[model samples]
Structures are given as C-alpha cells and as structure tokens.
Target: MSPQTDDVALSTTAERKVVVQSAGAQPDKDWVIVTRGLKREYDMGGEIVRALQGVDLAIRKNEYVAIMGPSGSGKSTLMNLIGCLDTPNGGEYWLSGQLVSTMKDDELARVRNKEIGFVFQTFNLLPRATALHNVELPLVYAGVGSAERKERAMEALTKVQLGDRAMHRPNELSGGQRQRVAIARALVNRPAILLADEPTGNLDSTTSEEIMRVFETLANTGQTVIMVTHEPDIAAHARRVVVLRDGKIASDERNQKVTSSLGL
Candidate 1:
C-alpha cells in the first residue's frame, strides 16, 4: 500500500480504537507501539507529581505521528516511556509485539537498543568523535564488528546526504550538519521506531525545515516516526497530531493540510 493510504487508515478513530484494544491480547505486528492505560507518577519531598494519567496511544507501523503539548503537559514523560528510557509505574507498553513496561533494567536496555532510535534536541553527538564514529556508536554497543559498523555508519550518513562529512567532528560542522549527523546516528540502528524529542529545537527556522524534510522522506519510505514537540508548525509536518493536556490526551487528529502540503 502507498504511504498515503497507510496514513489515512491509521488516522481514523475506529482504527485507533482497534489498535488500543488489541494491546491487551496477543500483540499485533501491524501496531508498532501500543500503550494501554499508561500512568506515571513521582514523589518529590513528600509531594506527588502525576506526570501521566492513563494515556492510551497506539501507533501503527510506518505512521508519522507528532505528540504535542505545552510545558508540564507530560509530553516529555510520554516520550521517555515510549523510548524505554523510563518505565511506567502502572499499565502496559508494547513495542514490536513485546510487553516491555515491566522489563528489568537490563532487559529494558536490550529492548531500547533493539527497538528505538532516538534523536535529541541537543544533537547529542560525541564532541570528539567523527560523524562516522558517532553514527557507529549504537552498532558498537550491539557488538557488531568494526567493518560492518563502518559500512552501516557510512550508509546512514549517505542517507542524510552527509557522506562527504564522515570524517568531520561535531564542532567542525554547522548546526544543521551536526543535527544531520545525529539523525544518521539515530537511523544507523535500523530501529522499529525513530523517536525524536524536539529534534529541531536548537536549529533556526530554515534548518528546522531541512530536518523536517528529512523526517518526511523517511516516513514516506515506510519508517515509523514519533516526534515530541511544542511547536505547532514543526508538529504540523507529521501526518497525525496528538495533543496532551493535564497528563491526558486532549485531541488526536489527522493533519490533512500538512500531509497534502508535504505530498505525503
């Protein structure tokens, strides 16, 4: 099926409900991610902070989704949970058909390494490492051989149109180039979901659009992407937008205008 068809199929409220309901049964491969009644809370000096309250989110394979919210709206918390950086205090999280919310630290680490590719707002490339080396870091952690890692890293850099800059260090590149390297690093792992948190936050408007175009291409080519951002314009690039308020989902809608504008 075409990417456009997939986008429309997943946008319907009925389809979303089906995916969410399937989360409790045997996992469906079509649903790349599912969170059922997910909840998170924290205690600070005897005061409780509820970061997430029963958030039910289902993202299908090849979906391009943006999770948006204002400050203190729990978008960051939800991103953490989805990325396996943090586990929920209650409820379930299934990624690639595996229940991961209750996984141990080491198990979580393994799942994170295998299932999620994360791009951060700060462009978290190693300062001293070359772009190629930075992109190879995840493969190194996975115990891939040096030659294979190098090959895959080079391929990822080429995907981002940074093949010629493989030897360049982060400091040697412009902000846009650095973010491209970070994106290459994220994609090098061939993860199930590309989870980007404020990926273009540090860049100027022009650079942000450049990165969004890269994301758009990836999504069009059947990559599953979940982005967390507060900027409406940035979020608009996604095919679907889910807004959060007071630790709950306020609205979920298809961005038909943005979708058509991007030719997705």
Candidate 2:
C-alpha cells in the first residue's frame, strides 16, 4: 500500500472524540479526564436500571489506565460516558477542562470527534473499506482537507507499523493485523485520550500481546490511554488498574510499571 493511499482513507465514526492536545496544551500538567458524582440510568418497562451511581474518577494526561469489572457492573456504561458516545443522567464530566455534560448535542459531537478516539471490542472497521480508508474516517468528518488528511492518516498508520497494509480490507487481514489497523484509526485523530473497550477480546494470547505493545508505544509517546477489560492478564499491561463493582469504584491501584522499569 502506498503511504499516500493510507493517508486519504475515509472516516469511521466509532465513539465521540475531540482534540484537546496542543504543544501549549499543558504538557506536564496533570488531569486530562475528570468525573464527579457520575450516574446513568435507564428505563425498562417503567423500571429503573441504574448503570452507574455516584462514580468519581480523575485521570492524568499521558496516563495508562484500565477499568475492570464483571458484566452489569457498569464498566461499559462508564466507558461510553468517558468516550462521549452517550451522556449521563446525572453528574459532571470534564475533558481537557471542558464540561462535557453541559454541552449540547452538536457541541458534544464536536468534542467527541476532536478530543477522544475509541476502539471497540469488535474492531468495527467497515467491511467494504480498505484499512487505510478506515483509519482516515475521523479526519474526514472533522473537515480536514484531502491532502492534509491523507498525510496525517498515513502517519498514524506508520505509528502502528501498518503502513504497508493500507490497501487491504478487514477480511483480507489476520485478526492481529485487523486490530492493528483499528488502533491506527484510533490514533489518526490524535485525540486527547484513546478509549478502548475490551480491545483484546477477540485475539489470541500472542496477538493480544502484540496489540498491547502498540498501546505501550503510544503511552511512551505521551498518549493518554484508557482501556476497559475484564481479563486480569490484559489489565496487567496498564500502568494503573481501577476496579468497578456494584456501580461504584471498588478499588484503584497502581500496577507495576514493568515496561518502563525493565526497558521492555
């Protein structure tokens, strides 16, 4: 695949994202994400289902964090809120110091397109689109011009070492390669946070490790990453782990930084 082709691919609307990172964008400053008294509820046949109840979280810029919990524990709901895919029934959410919860639909959509990049459990690439086009989807929606958009997209693909497979479609690639392409798509927009939900759910152990390595490289480059996974092995790759239970934070702890500590 030519680098030029990789750069010009179309946009894929995964979750919402907005661009909050700039050189003067508080490089060393902490706190890229913050939430207070967060809550989300749903009505089912006139019954209330509380997905999250009074959750509070603070994440710093460039931090690698993971949210872990069993099904029905609100992990996915929290991820959606964080990813800006959905709004909460009650609470405050701040992204790069902007109040996301208070924004209207158009404002929220802009924030999501520019500030956050999302990776799904299924990869979510368009079946008919080539890998490069899939990665370029976000840039297209942001009103980026063709030439510049292609350049940025290609750069992102290169970051994940997928520059050579830009022309291949999802069906033509292996599971690991497909996920790598998805990761490239997530990074293409250079969002403030790369939000991933069960990114390794469909991959085998070796492939999963390969995917995590891409994440590690991203973190090393000062990318803020927040991933949701239930597997302990996958969570171990994160710098810190936060466990949710019964719609609340059960435990939050710093995992060993083996990557940085051992220079892996």
Candidate 3:
C-alpha cells in the first residue's frame, strides 16, 4: 500500500467546538478518535500533578500515528485516556463516533472490549496458553462460541505470519514471536483501533525491526494504529508523529520519510 498523510490541519477552534458540543452527539464519521480539552490530574503527596492539561487531538480512521514525548510530558496520560484505560478529568473524548469520556466504568470496560485492541510492552499473553488460545481469549470474553473463536484466532495469527506457531506457548517463542502473538491477539477482535504502548521496548534491535514490520504491514492494511513510544527511531515507523510537552501538544507533523521495515 502507498504511504498516506494526515491532511487535517490542527485547528484549536474546531477542537473547541467539538468539546463544547452537546454531550451524546455522535462525532463525524470521518474521525475515528477525537479528544477536546482533555485533562487529567493526580494527587501526589498532597500536591497536585497535572498530567494532561487540555489536550486536543483528532485521529482519522486508518491513521498510523505515534504519540511521543519525554518522561512526564503527558504522552502516557494521553495514551491511557485514548486507550480508555483512564478517563480525563475534563474534556470530551470521542472514539469511533461515540462520546466515550462520559461513559461509566462498566460502560468504558465494554467500550474497551468492543472498540479497542491493546498491545503492551510486556506482550501480556497467558504464559500457560498456546498462542492460538491466547488470541482466542478476547473472543471468549465476548462470549463467542468455541469453533468461531478458534477460527478467528487462527486467521489473526496467520495475518502475523505465525500460523505455524499457533500451538506454541509464550515461553517457547522468541521475543519477536511473542510480540507477534500479542499483536495477533489484539487483531482478533477487529477493533476500531490497535493501541500499542512501547511495543518494541523489550526486543533487541533486530527483533524490534521484525516487530515493526508486522506493525507496518498492519498499517498498510488499513488498521488505525496509535503507538505510544519515546524512542524516535520506533516512532519513525509511524506516518505521523505527535509530540507532547508540558502537558500539551508541542508538535504534530507528518514524517516525510517513514522508516521501512527492510531498512532501506
């Protein structure tokens, strides 16, 4: 697939309008994820630590974006909010046309299950389960039947080119293979977005490139992937990079030269 760019310019005015819009209104279909004036704070030792301070972001469907920043730049907080793992104290978060920021915990949990697929740095697979079984876990949680779950899991594994290792456990797989299995598990549910947090953090340089190629393939296939990483080289794998600083967006730009998996 040919490389693409995020043509939507950053408009604070538009973001503010989306923020002030009446709650429960569906976002425009073009935007798969939107955050307006998103804010989050933590109480630390009787002092308040403002992690995210009114962040406004918009991501369209099939966008391969990287959220990058130094430590304490609020990228992690932004990721948590985007992933629906945490809610912003202020502002509206819309995911796949739904206003998810206002959702309750249980509702958010359901939304996470139905709308988001997560790949963590640790490759959080069940140590005892085979790659196929690990991939099947999400469908199981969704109450899918046995046969269909297995079939979908296998197909997802096949997408990552790990079909032959479906029966292998995490302990039996290499670091890259385990991450691929995790990616397969994330894709099994066909979620609206694949959210990866420091996906290649645990791998060596060679293995990291291997995992990156899998992500590259997924992005080429129209997957909306948002990866949170501090490493510039890893972030370069994404077509667009958004850098956060001092709890706000410092820079958002397209990478003119996206890195290829083949190291061209």
Clashes of each: 0, 16, 0
> What's the distance in Å from true for residue 19, model 3?
9.1
Candidate 1 per-residue lDDT, tens place, 1-264, comes to: 476656543657777787777546746788898899899998988999999999988888888999999999999999999999999999899999999998999998888878899999999999999999999999998999999999999999999999999999999999999999998998898999999999999999999999999998998788999999999999998889999999999999988777577563
Q: Which ten residues in a row have the lowest lDDT in candidate 2?
A: 9-18
Model 2 scores what on Cα lDDT?
A: 0.81
lDDT of each: 0.91, 0.81, 0.87
**Model 1 misplaced stretches (Cα beyond 4 Å):** 1-9, 262-264
The reply for model 3, stretches above 4 Å from the true place, is 3-25, 259-264
**Candidate 3, residues 1-264: lDDT per residue as tens digits?**
543333342223455356445445556776788787899999999999999999878887788889999999999899999999998899889999888898899899888888899999999999999999999999998889999999999999999989999999999999999999999999899999999999999999999999888988888778889999999999998888999999999987767676444235
Best of the two (1, 3) by lDDT: 1
Model 2 compared with the native: what TM-score?
A: 0.86
Model 2 C-alpha lDDT per residue in residues 128-183, reported as the tens digit of each score? 99998998899998999989888888888888888898889999999999998888
Decreasing lDDT order of the candidates: 1, 3, 2
Which regions in candidate 2 have their CA more than 4 angstroms from the true location? 1-29, 257-264
Give the number of the best model, judged by TM-score: 1
- Ranked by TM-score, the better of candidates 1 and 3 is 1
Q: Which is the leading candidate under lDDT?
A: 1
